[model samples]
Target: MSSADDPKTARQPQPPSHAMVGTWRLVSYDVEVASTGERFPAMGERPTGYTIFSGEGRVWFMLTGDGRQPGDSDRDRAQLLETLIAYSGRYRIEGDVWVTAVDVAWNPAWVGTEQRRQFALDGDRLQVRTPWRVMPNWADKGETRSIITFERAVEG
Candidate 1:
């Protein structure tokens, strides 16, 4: 069976350490256009993603649009690239903010950078928000803020 079909392989929740140390399955990912206040999905409405945090300060994150199939051409490959995001690094949680000191990222520009996101935990669900930043491929249009939600992965 495909990995997507198995919850165990899709994401497994790590033992809790603080509030952020756990595997999380993406539930929703949206970005709000700063100027217009219009929210749109960052990777379509049904994006698939996972974030895993270890008690030892390590973290891994990845997200991609659903329904992506193997690409056979350059355009297809580019499309795939445009639909995905991945990064990994050490992380620290301070108060209500979590910061990731990126060691590696799909985008070279993110390497060596620190990314901060405000987060809150409500029962088994997690919500995170990014600060407003220039929109990719549409910087001139306006800034955008990413808002994502996740739920702790349940082991079968």
Candidate 2:
């Protein structure tokens, strides 16, 4: 068959609303400072995370840094909390952007807030990015843009 007629090659890009409905595994997460062009890992060089988009308009996401060990001390608990992010809520796709209305979040401050991310899809990979915003816990650090990439999870 001609390449243009092949199923894989012929598949057109789906709308974000349909294209995003699946489980995705985190590949990388980074942040770039607007002022200096300096880029750093939002979590770590090897962060771990999952993002799930349902056809029913529900979304769930979680992410954490690597090398975490259980600790009973308050310091450890604080460290743990600092290294993790999680939230769940309804989502909608508008143009090329995905907006999430947070119903619940690990950080209480995020609850009831609408988070927006620009998205791009290429085959099995998806990249979502945040517009420049002051890092929540580090407002003095200046504005930052978060970039996160994910690969569609394979069903077992």
The TM-score values for the models, in the order shown, are: 0.84, 0.85
lDDT of 1: 0.87
RMSD value for candidate 1: 10.2
Write candidate 2's Cα lDDT for 44-139 as tens digits: 789999999987788899999877889799988888998898999888898889899999999999999999999999999999999888977657
Q: At residue 141, give the lDDT of candidate 1.
A: 56
**Tens digit of lDDT per residue, candidate 1, span 30-50?**
988888888878788799999
TM-score of 2: 0.85
Tell me the whole-model lDDT of each prediction, alpha carbons only: 0.87, 0.89
